[model samples]
Target: MKRFYIYLLAFLLPVCCLAQETVIIKRKLTNAVKERVSVLKSDNVTKQGLYQALWDSKTVLANGSYTKNVKTGIWNFYDTKNNVIQRFNYTTNTLLYEAPEDSATNCRYVVDHTVRDTDRTTKPIVIGGRFFGYINYLRLFRLPPDMRNINNEVVVPTIELLVSPGGRLAEYIVHFQAENYDRKVGFNIDYLSDEDKTFIPATINGEPIACRIFIRCFLTSGGDLDLF
Candidate 1:
């Protein structure tokens, strides 16, 4: 019996070691954004482990585990400051945590600018949270050549997002106002990327309702879009 037990232990040790071996892969998404994934290769070569998307190779933007290349369990999406903006349980298809409306922080970037005098129980949230919206805006927004030379002045641009009751972006409006210059640009919902069209609509009494969300941004001296 002792000899049989010794043989079984030896057989299991190699299997444990093989299962623990994880391969880490890094992918560059942009000049400052990248992704790192820790995966265990199966016979099918599908991603089967931890995944993280990062900015500046340090701040984690999103992280979760994958099962057979599908997101599982709870995933955390973060802001540039490394705050957990949203926590979602993919397996259960439920929101676990969403950062409360804080006018000092997240709200400075994305705000519910609807002109409703009534109060709402919850504000509309972008699919991945405020940071996701901010990043996408930075990626897609282009500065007009005429506004490039403005210096020592702060310019605020309002991006209006009309979210439908079904959590879809219905319309987009951009109000660019600078010194003696005011231009409003309208865009169809079809112009947005598929990912950007997703949102968690606002609610008043546990019932979803269409609302308008505004992404407010300012331009820096270097002509870069930044949060207010």
Candidate 2:
């Protein structure tokens, strides 16, 4: 055990020593765009260094290698408002991660969840605003925003997914008090067809809480179910 600790320390010490201590500059790409570059942990200290890039004060790319201060490999890019525009993933000389498949059923759900463009229960109905547009139906029912907080003082929201025979689609219901910022967003997702309903259990920190759920429901044309 003592020998193991010594070996571990020896291996990590160099990494710690080579870590860059601060951000040297924050540059604006344009009136609406801002970015920062900072030196961070780097491998191959003798020949290379690594740096991190931030857009709109958000760390979009990290551990970017530089050969004698020349940028190399994959780097992240952001939009003018600091939203992630594209991710450049590089390994030697190849590209991975293909764009999502396009299908009539799939496209409908995509717009329903992520963009909340339309409600699945009601055909040709659209909902506008944040959490609107399309989303992956299989992955709907997101946890409360406060659930991410480390303090654990806030209450987490619960989600339930349901599918119906009429729509032949998936839907979700979120249950939680509004005090903790509990809000519901539904989507069409991929899942097993055999199960009509599913209740997934989750937690917020150590306290027991149901966070998100994924389910399917039925949808029929000529019905207007968009209540709001």
Candidate 3:
């Protein structure tokens, strides 16, 4: 047992030392437009790096990984706002999967209390953002601006959203209340993101699957947001 622990540490130490890799830099590929090299992370093993060409400072333009000095893992290309417009997964320098802008990260998801298994087909695995991440996503939800502008009166909104199979948001329905916001409230959904208008998507056998969830919001005139 002690020898096994010693061997495990020996194998892990080199990988740990490789974690503090350096970033590389280059210049002058503005294209016909004004694109420039922004940030880069290089692998010392192959002396190669991944470059993110950013026209804007806040957004990542493109990102990918390299294995054995070849581009591997998931590469994401973003637009001006840093939203991923394209995503491609590469393994051994081969394209494994690719997704266009409109269909990437747009689906919402829900939680499943049941565990399912398949014989010849495995369940879809939720990648990118994992399924349980929706809890933190919901913690970030806030009342919409129009709903919050209600003259300091109580506001209640019942929201229902659909999570598509691609782990993106499908649609949302919200019913706004006026001044009488002091109503009963309970939340049965898994998670909420972007102010109760979006959600996380679940996957079946490693693919995004669709699900529905509800959000009960109780905005009080007492200057506090009460939700369960």
Index of the highest-lDDT prediction = 1
Q: What is the C-alpha lDDT profile of model 2 across 139-210, one tens digit per residue? A: 333434444432222333333443232223345554343464544544435453322232222222322232
Report RMSD (Å) for each prediction in the order shown: 5.2, 20.3, 17.2
RMSD of 2: 20.3
Q: Using TM-score, rank the candidates from best to worst.
A: 1, 3, 2
Tens digit of lDDT per residue, candidate 3, span 125-164? 2222221212233343455544445654445555455666
Q: TM-score: which candidate is best?
A: 1
Q: Where in model 1 is the C-alpha error above 4 Å? A: 1-32, 37-48, 67-69, 106-120, 143-153, 187-195, 219-228
Q: Summarize candidate 1's per-residue lDDT along 130-165 as a digit string, tens digits.
A: 765445655555666775675526556777777787
Model 2 backbone overlap count: 31
Clashing pairs in 1: none
Q: Global lDDT for candidate 1?
A: 0.71
lDDT per model vs. reference: 0.71, 0.34, 0.45
Whichever of 1 and 3 has more lDDT, that candidate is 1
